[model samples]
Target: MVASPPARFSVPAVTQPRINEANRKSVGPLSMPPRLLLGPGPSNAHPAVLQALSLRQVGHLDPAFLAMMTEVQELLRYAWQTDNRITIPVSGTGSAAMEATIANVIEPGEVMLVGSMGYFGNRLEDMADRYRADVRTIKKPWGEVFSLEELRSALEEHRPKVMALVHAETSTGACQPLEGVGDLCREYNCLLIADTVTSLGGVPLFVDEWGIDLAYSCSQKGLSCPPGASPFTMSDRAFEKLSQRPGKVPNWYLDMSLVGKYWGAERTYHHTAPINMNYAIREALRLIAEEGLENRWQRHQANAELLWEGLEDLGLVLHVQKQYRLPTLTTVRVPAGVDAKAVTSQLLNDYNIEIGNGLGELGGKVWRIGLMGFNSRPENVILLLAALDRVLAAAGYRK
Candidate 1:
């Protein structure tokens, strides 16, 4: 073979595949309906926040980007009213941050007690199950919240390593009061996790004061940003538990011991952070800082009350009781003969409004209307009320 010079052969020309005209469909520039999102999430982002989202990109590790990241962290700390050293945003939706808490804090066989009052509580149980936790749930009907006594009884009965509660239940529009729940967990030697996904910026939340060992939220709902990046924080107590874990975190992407370095002083590489989402959230949080928390909370409350009054004026029944109702989301009971889906559909199609049909056990029974972040304005409340009155009259509902 060597003597024959390997019998030199000529290669045939290769034709790279081009765009197949048969399979390729012509597409035009992007266009979307200007939908006013008044549903159980993804409320319309503030115009300024959207502008930040569309701003130019930067390398994930650029020094300017790193500085911006620090600003983002400080702003987030203000938003959550926490000084947790490891506060950061996960590079996914709110649910990803939800799982991050379970993944980092739980070992395979640990007992985890969840307060399952609404759909998201069930979600917590499901994620805990996937992590191989021995899950226990203390239940209540949708549109209702567990009392401090109920939680104390559950903690005494389950004696779990971790206890999780939803600070704001999105599905049922109920805000679970957490003022003393954290102390109860401490008495039982259990870590506390709070789901602030629907509460964080819009409602009053005190992570450290309430002793929330771990907490998570979404940017889309209360932060007035898009849905990609989510807020997550852990107290020293939770972090200490994580540090003593017998094994590596079960979910690698969400392992905070590794992910924290990137957000902390070490500045190590984790995954590429969501630069644009960080920018968007920083701007949104900045707006919050400028407006002040008390003012924002008042704004959201005033607007929600406005909506509730208008709904009641229309003879629509509120789902949750007044004291437990969430300021960000409201559940309205469907009139006996009205089709819930039809009402929601009319709101979306005719009025350019988008309120949610119910979820889980509430489907076809209640309508979820959101007044969160930037969307929580008196003008929006008036618009939605006017639209709903018209839509309901057309739907053949007596009231």
Candidate 2:
């Protein structure tokens, strides 16, 4: 026993290496807990979508991948409810899609009449300006919808070559009525363009019926996919505009005339398409197809009604009027004494939930809640109401 005790070996200290110039930027591994995504975008991806993304990777130009891409284009056509041959997904976020539509449609020095209702409406105006178009805005108060009269007056006054509007204003939860505006644009001989980023899939978006010449949407919002892919659809008229551009589009990455070749029958290469993201988008569209368009719209409408009832029961004021409120996104007035940011932070930290704060003029004055696609469910409505009640109570706001 004494001899055995004397044979023990000492252990050496294991030291981690210090940061060197080459490795200084390297970060440690990250761990993220699954949190409920109820923000303006990036709602939860469907399980099937997640499964699709996990499938084996293939070369970007692989025949199978290209076949899948074609299927995706067709599926997007169904989701967009359009037969436009040039419809395809751009390899970027919603903003890229918006830029692509604008760049393709507007020539330098062309006038673009834009609606200024909230943040995204302002973004359209800015994009028009960047593209060297003379931008004219029909301004409406934040949290308010623009009337047909308002849009008609703007069209009469500006006579812009292109009229741009946000079908669903995420910032103020306002859904602009497309029926009259589209007709007005037709009457004015202006190409109608819309940002449907927050309305697609969750709402009834009829590109052809609305006479929208060009429209774009993100996968993350109503499609229940990740944010890297943006679905863009264009009418033949808009494509003709692209064909007749006096000069090259400002952004090559978004040049539809060239990009169409890759997504077209030619199977040419514009850039490396995001293969995995396409898979996710395909799966997301599949889910929407299974749900059926009318049923999906009704589901969103029903969930939004529940949310409205709950918020009203709690004595909260909805920002947008009943007729104009977006079904997928709701904006509620931030009570006078409550700190909107604090309530949002508590909801995120304590409940593992995310909600959006108001944007632009509505900032610090309203809270924007999204009930989009997969995130629009009865359980989510209840969860949000209960959590918000707790938050408001703690903030000394009476229920």
Could you say which candidate leads in lDDT? 1
Model 1, range 1-399, lDDT digits (tens) per residue?
Answer: 454334356455557647676655765577999999999989999999999999999999999999999998998899999999989889999999999999999998899999999999999999999999999999999999999999999889989999999999999999999999889999999999999999988999999999999999999998899999999999999999999998899899999999999999989999998889999989998999999999999999999999999999999999999999999999999999898999888899998999999999999999999999999999999999999998899988766
Record all residue pairs in model 1 with backbone atoms less than 3 Å apart, i.e. clashing: none
Return the top candidate by TM-score.
Answer: 1
User: Would you estimate the TM-scores of all the predictions?
Assistant: 0.95, 0.93
lDDT digits (tens) for residues 197-296 of candidate 2? 9999998888887889999999999998989999998899889888988789889999998999999999898999988999999999988888999999
Worst 10-residue lDDT window for candidate 2 reads 1-10
Scanning candidate 1 in windows of ten residues, the lowest lDDT window is 1-10
User: Cα lDDT for residue 23, model 1?
Assistant: 54
TM-score for model 1? 0.95
